[model samples]
Target: MPQTLDAAAVRTWCSLALEALGREREEIDAINVYPVADGDTGTNLYLTVESAAQAVEAVFAAHETGSSVPAPADVVRAMAHGALIGARGNSGTILAQLLRGMAERLGDGDHLAGALHRAATLAREAVAHPVEGTILSVAGAAAQAADAFPQDAVRAAYEGARQALDATPGQLAVLERAGVVDAGGRGLLMVLGALVEAVTGEAPVAPVLAHVRHEIGDPGLEPCAAGGPAFEVIYLLEADDAAVARLRTRLDGLGDSLVVVGGDGLWNVHVHVDDAGAAVEAGVEAGRPYRIRITHFDTTAPPREREQVQRAVVVVVPGEGLAGLCAEAGATTVLARPGEPPASGELVDAIRRAHAREVVLLPNSAELRHTAAAAAEQARTEGVRVALIPTRAAVQGIAALAVHEPDRRFDEDVVAMTAAAGATRYAELAVAERQSWTSAGVCQAGDVLGLIDGDVAVIGADLADTAEAVLDRMLAAGGELVTLVLGEDVPDGDAVADRLERYVRDGYLAVDTLVYRGGRGSTPLLVGVE
Candidate 1:
């Protein structure tokens, strides 16, 4: 086991903690009974540590660029700052303070025991109403254990936190009734266990809570679950400690789960209150607050498993109308603007936010192929099963989504979606911005160009004529259904749809057609035949 902690060890600890949390997030969320039962404690902690790990990785990247390594103090500070800024929910906000306190003491020539002791005190101070049988209790116990066995700091801390976690049910009435330990305390114990593994290179034995029971689905026992304030408001505030003190008192009166963490001029504020506006306005009265997030508590519902979300779809589409359509069809959507496409990081974030074990990704633009593939690889690393369908147009994604069946086997579902997307022939009507060369021939600025499968196929002065020509060509290849996506620039509104429908009716009597408004900033019109 490592006798001394350093920057490298801290980085390792962050990674280990994130991995452990990722694996156990759902379990911890299930046992959440204190403060509020929104069933996101595990996700919150994982996200908070994920942010810290990312920040630590950034530091390493910067140091690598400089051909140097960051000092232990600098590494610890970055970890704390990342946690503070990215802290989510009540438990996560308190955890940020715990890490911040440890960073302060650890950087000031303190030993592991002393730093842990300081961490516990600061965590207790951060909470507006410090209660027993929580993470605060577990932290305090770990500190005591560390001081008592300074030579084996990591093991002592883990043992102490584990014992404290086991005893939490007796300390909190809600925990006893729910037949579970404090969820936040359990999460903290996992972090401590990760630290031990970082030092020893051997995973510690997980603590067993044999007394704890699971009555999650029983309605009779469900109503016994704890409840809290209506809305949870969190933000980052830039203010003096004095101003923060007054703000704390005002928030304490507003609601519970009030935690104000951070130091100096920057603070991470969290509170559960009925009046979200009042909580935010209180922050304004204290200082400038930004990155504010508010979540309403669905008090009637029971805590459920988020990490076990069976399947979800994440799609990249252009225009708000397509986004709405995808969302209505139960898919998470990322909007691609006219001149800007979503980066790989955006797609990865959307995949994570989708919160599913299995995800079907639709990159509905040719330029996004590589980016979407990269995102899929990154998400897979985080244990999300991702299938990237190279759909070159929004209409192809629509066709793929039409055939999507979450209940089917994953591989079969992927194959069906892939086949549907590949079989759909897509084209778009766009105005030429200037005299340009095209596959159809040279075109003037006033000309409307019909692009089929990423190549200009026809050009005409009239929108109706151009669209008709493209449709007939697409149908000549054989199609039973025609999808018309009308954009904001379609000058004649329903006239364009009326004309297109009439054209298909007169010539292709066996074919059916459908129309959708593609919203503003989209191409003049999009056509898909399948």
Candidate 2:
């Protein structure tokens, strides 16, 4: 085993931590009592580590195309940034600050003990009000132990954290009353154990407590305490350090459990408050805030009436317009850049973000089929039932969505959506980049080209004439509905859409045409006949 951290070791640490948390999420969540008593500490830590792992993987991926390996500093920085943006809950936000502190002190890895001390210090500063019998206490104890045993610091830190976690009940009344140790401290111990495993070849065994409290029923659906805050607000903000400093003050006054973590003009703000709108407005005054989430807690629901999260639709689209369209239709849209297609890892990340038991994946580009299928398999291994719909075009995916019924059985639903997508025929209108030979004939560089079902079918000089010819050929095969999606470069005016509609009216009496704006993309227009 390696004695010090490098990019590879850092990557290993992240993966180990995420897997550990995933295994213990429900157990940690069950015993949660401090900081509002919402039993999601384990889930929050898993998500935070998952984000950090993704960022580290991205750094390694960027270097894979070349021969260079990422520096230890680069890996640590990515881990810190990922945790900052993806942090959740009170414990999670503090954990982000701790990781950031380590990033600040990371060097040749000989100073592992020093880095641990710095991390503990930074975490303490990030909290609005530091309390004992929490993750902060565990972090401090671990750092002190590491400082004493610098030769074997990683293992020392894990043992120190586990011992501190055992003493948490004496430090806090809530935990003592609940017959459990601090939940956040327990999670910190789990993370430290992973770090120990990373340094040594053998994994550390988790400590078993004698006075454990096993919470009955689904803890997530339970109500909060009588006098607690009614809402949870989270958002990512873009602002300077001075602005964030002021924001921290404002939010601290507005609510409890306030955490603002990040630096260099980007930060993630999370808080619990009765005035959710006021909290968000304070962020706006400081800087621009987006991806805002506000959830209201209901205390009156019975256990039987508590609602569970439903299955979700996960889709990959090329342009912003299609993303918005899919989002509006209740699908989680992953935007694929013009040239850089999403990898299997990215697709898997999107599936995890969906946070659903069942998922329907729409890889709207033909090139993304294998990647999407691979992602689906990975998700299945993680206990998520995923269905991959091999949609070769955005319009085909749209057609499939139109017929989707999540309330139906999973297999039945997949079959219906697949059939709907398969029944649609798609084509695109583009301008030839250079003189090229086609099925119709050789075409000039500026000539309009109509590609039907992935082949050049009609070539002409005028956009209107070429579109009409393509529509005529498609209608000859007998289609009842025609979808016209216009791109950004298309000339302003309803000329193309109107002319096509008039042509259909003059010849095909029963065909109906619908038009949609496709925003900016490579193709000038996309046609779907169903």
Candidate 3:
């Protein structure tokens, strides 16, 4: 049964498209041969869709406290705006324009055919010279199919895009010579398939591109002929339409694969040129360009010769022992001392020390969320791929690290670690410094406070008593495993761990407990229930 096109449907579409792209990213990159292939078309498209999905999620989050759901128009518009601002590479820029075009028509009405037609037209117009046998042709074909089959437009459009993708080789000399379809057209087909899945509750079968794998020889081999542009430059510009018009003309004169997409005082500019600085200077003359990214093409070097580490983990630990523990588990550690958190620069430094092309950053403290995000952005500017997992405690970080697998796809590994962290509930035992009010109740100086999920949950006179109380409370909610980390300064810390381990074994059926000693300057104790 097909669902009506609405806010929820649009959100679903973005999510499905992002997931589809992630799964096919490497395959698409293998087949990339047009507009100067640097082997990142799939990654670029995935990032673009990820931004759009994040924007849609933000809209839902904003409306969560309100009485009404966000309107469909608002969701679609946010999706387009997000793509426009985050667009990367030639294909991604065109994708942003296509979404923006559909958004323009969809905001006015719910006619799918009209939106598809507008998207195709805008995408073709965004390119400097409309080329056949590309994403533009696929979009045009989908739009035509949608217009012809209004009742089953989503499925018809998907089918039409699939056909166009298959015929791309015959239409383009490069694709024909490579024995592969257009990478951008294939990506567009995946997006259209996602739309079909969103409208109807079933995913259509994706077309096989086995010929791409056979023709490309090795996945690492660059398929395109050498000697195009030396650099690919992209930036977001805050400028008027007239300035963008001039910027497009200037960029077209500078190099090939010119794409300028956006409207209403903002634009995403993408071009490949031998002189990257000159392209950027043109943007400066036309408008204020920010988020400017200039990537040099190493056309002479083989992909295997690139000095890039595959992946690594960087974690922020609260104590030396925890740091050592994480380091032993193959992570790069940044120690945060008592009463002092590591700054964003420190995290960036740790990321650099890891020397990985892709890094998973675990800033295991709630207070460092913004700091970690800033560090991730800075690292991205330096060409280091970073994913920040929000683990609010050492115990949560432990949970995440336990499930980490570097061999898996980056996105899949991040998802697994995030899920493991989220499933574990964390708490800490600390001595109060002075009289204070808390979620549990008031506590006097020197009182032992048990904080669950960052809130005071129990206040007791003895460490053992308080630990027992917290365990009982946490177990009342049902947990299979209990992780305890004892502080070096805590008196009789071993005794407490021993007693708690026995307490859990005797009191709870099928529940297990593990203990670790958090070296000097650590919190009194940390607990995790999972």
Candidate 4:
């Protein structure tokens, strides 16, 4: 039985697409040969779909508070907006545009064929120089097929996409020479197949790529040729239509494979350029750009024989200073932004990037326990020995890192690090957002909150006063060392640390104090006693 194109179907489509992409990511990456062949098309598509799925979930969560469910328009729009902001690479950026186009039509109550046609048009328009036999061509074919068979649009579109994917090698000279289909087109076909399953409750037959199993040096299977752009630059920009138009012209002159996708004053910009700095500068001139990422094309060695380190530490931190501190300690650091926590895939990526035989993962938050465990399990399946130390806070992770000895036996090192983290007690100072009752007492908005071991233990009107009271409470049990991490937003942070250090020195006979800046997005202060 065929399902109607509604909010539920859209949700199912995102889920199925993400799952399919996850299973096919590595295979897709292995076949990537065009547009510089950094070999991350599958990963990019997976991440983009993941973002869209998360956004759709967020909508459902918000609606759970009420009796009514979200409408199809809301769900589709959220999916498109999420993909646009989280889009990565050239293929991912174009996919975002395609989703946006479909959303524009579907939200307006257009049929499946009309939505597919709009998606194909918008995706082609998003690319600076649309080429034949790319994802765009496959998209056009899917739209045409959908139009021709409106009664069975989803299945027809998927079949059309599979045919286009098979014909890609014949249409693109590079793909033909490499003996592989267009990687982007292949990924899009998977997405369409997922849609077919979503609408009709039946999975389509998977398409097998030509020469997919061929080795790097196999006859008729040429590897990705070198010598293209030095860097791939991407950024999210907040700009008006006029500014984006000018930016498109400026970027077109700077590099090739340019893709600018988004609307309603926000855009995702991607381009491959020799002068990476100039590309970024152009974005700055156009609008306020942030979350900028620039990747050098020549960083990794060939996948076959890359050497792995004996041991490595991967930790999550809350701020730039902490990231820098952990990096200096020879650990790979993942920055956990205030509202956006890293997904398990990101952790898995970090584990791979560490490129070590044995890895120690410190999530640095109690909330990330499941996510960390999942990543560790995934890494283990890939043959990396991963030890997850359940450090509930950054301070605990710091203590664990302090005791990490990579030269020691893996088990011994892990035991020592775990013990060190378990022995440390962490607390933080935060401002109250609203009036609420706490373990200590009823608190009003604008009150300073002192949390000890994840509980609100004290509340005051002054930062210094609240911090001192919290420190006194934590030190009552007797501690040898006091570690203070001050946020960048705190006023007179240096003076506060100095005052607290003097207070501890004068009060305690032999206890020591060390202070560090947590930089932006940190709590006002974090205190760890050991």
Predicted structure with the largest lDDT when compared to the true one: 4
Between candidates 3 and 4, which one is better according to TM-score? 4
Q: Which window of 10 residues has the lowest lDDT sum in candidate 3?
A: 215-224
Query: Model 1's lDDT to the true fold?
Result: 0.86
Flag the better candidate by lDDT, 1 or 2.
1
Instruction: Provide TM-scores for the models.
Output: 0.64, 0.74, 0.63, 0.90
Query: How far off is residue 329 in model 2, in Å?
Result: 5.1
Tens digit per residue, CA lDDT, model 4, 1-530: 34237999999999999999999898888778777666789988888888788788888988998999899999999999888877888889999999999999999988888899899999999999999988998999999999998888888898888888888889988888778888899889989999998888889987765535375334454434466677889998999999999999999999889999999999999999889999989989999887688888763444475688999999999888998999999999888877566777778889998999999999999988987998999899999999999999899999999999999999999999999999899999999999899999999999999999999999999898898899899899999998899999999998999999998999887899989999976788999999
In model 3, state the lDDT of residue 182: 84
In lDDT terms, how accurate is model 4? 0.88
Worst 10 residues of 1 by lDDT: 217-226
235-326: candidate 1 lDDT, tens digit per residue = 98999999999999999999888899998899999998989999999999999997677888877664475656888899987777888889
Q: Best to worst by TM-score, what's the order? A: 4, 2, 1, 3
Q: How many residue pairs of model 4 clash at the backbone?
A: 0
Model 1: which residue pairs collide? none
Clashes of 1: 0
lDDT of 3 by residue, 18-102 (tens): 8899788778988887866677788678768877887788899999998899999999999998888768789989999999999
| Per-residue accuracy of model 2 over 1-530 as CA lDDT, tens digit each | 34458888889999899888878887888877777666778777776777788778889989998989999999999999888876777788888888888788875465778889999998988788889999999999999999999888888888888889899989988787778888888888888888888878679986887557755443432246776788889888999999999999999998888878778898889898999999999999999986576767554443253243467788887666777888898888877655446556558767877888899999988988877887899799999999999999877888888889989988999999999889899888889989978988999999999988888999988888898899989888999888888877788637777888888888899998887777654367888899
